[model samples]
Target: MTGHDRAPGSRIDTSKPHPARMYDWWLGGKDNYPVDEEMGRKLLAIEPRIPIMARANRAFMQRATRWLAQHGITQFLDIGSGIPTEPNLHQIAQRTAPEARVVYCDNDPIVLAHAEALLRSTPEGRTAYLQADVRDPADILERARDTLDFTRPVALSLIALLHFITDEDGAYDLVDAFLQGLPTGSYLMLSHGTGQFTPKGAAEADELYKNSGITLALRDRHEVERFFHGLELVDPGVAVIDTWHPELGEPVEGQQDFQPMPGFGAVARKV
Candidate 1:
């Protein structure tokens, strides 16, 4: 809610590319505009493995969800949840725990337009969508409480999200604030795009996004690790996205040929 919900069929800006739409395009979804495809193709030229990386990021989310669910964690707060794709977080979590409660937050209007797909939940479980941004964690936590219980252990996921928020934008502070609302035993699952493997490609991609009026703040492994400062990193700490718990899910094709997918992922518990 948070008064960010738009009326059905609200105007969607097609003049430029949006991160959500571009991501949807990369995922081969049909919810994006032509401009998004144009930008996606341009990025693909810079990094041919982007689509594979996108799938790898999604697999990381699912694997982390399964891990949390297997550990008896049922509640989830997923921020910067992009356009809905198959086997969403709730679907992956609720498969193990039927009564899992999930709250998804996103600021993209197009996501709100298709949030109905995200609202579908198992009869025993619950799902809610909040049209909000990660910058305003207070409003997100307040609205998310309608479905998620902060007093209990909740898995907080920020997959492929923080890179859009720079340190100057208080990315670290916002993450700390969100974690502060959860109690002990809660988990933080995050995956961020990094420039470690391909610094020149990253710079070109960042500049391309900047020219398109989008912010792409790719970080290194050490910078990404900073987000999980006080938490206990799970086994294989801060490894490449696809390398973390590959057994929990199927491997993304063409991933083996790429150079570590140019991203990092890890899950940690707030003990």
Candidate 2:
């Protein structure tokens, strides 16, 4: 079962490509428009290994979610939960802890349209969706409370998010605000795009997104680690998404071909 969909009236915009839809395109999903494909193709032209990156990122999330579940984290609040894919966070979490509860939030109306896929919780668990942006952390945290108990430990998953948010937009402050709401022992799981290894290619991709009216801020390792400040980072600290905990999940088909996936992933606990 799932909670009610709380979306302030907003129409699905197809004129411009959305990050989530473009991401869907990268993942070979059918929930994207031509505009999104056009943009996705352009990005792929810059880096042919993008599809591998997409799958590797999902694999990282799966491994991280399973690790958290095995470690006794039963509640998940996944903000920026994009278009639903198979074996979502709830599935991985509830597989270990049947009574686990998950709340999915995303700003995209397209995701809201397909929210049902995210709501099919197991008989022993619960799921909910919220059509909201991460910028409005307060509103998301408040509504999420309806499905998740804030007093307990909740793993906040920000997978493949945050790069869209610029420092001018208070990205650090936003992360801090969400962390403040969670009690001690809560965890933050995040994956961020970086321009470190492929600086030239990363710059070109950033320009492409900028031209398409999207803000893609690929941070360096130091900048990405800033979000985990004051938290106890898990072993190996921040790492290339695929390398974080490879033993927890199976390998992606083309991940080895691409070397590093140009992203960093880490899980940190609030002490």
How high is the CA lDDT of each candidate model?
0.89, 0.92
What RMSD, rounded to one decimal, does every model reach? 2.2, 0.9
| Candidate 2 stretches greater than 4 Å from native | none
lDDT of 2 by residue, 31-135 (tens): 999999999999989998998998898998999999999999999999999999998999999999999999999988889889999998988889999988899
- Worst lDDT 10-window in candidate 2: 1-10
Q: How much is the lDDT of residue 213 in candidate 2?
A: 95
Clash pairs of candidate 2? none
Cα displacement (Å) at residue 137, model 2: 1.0
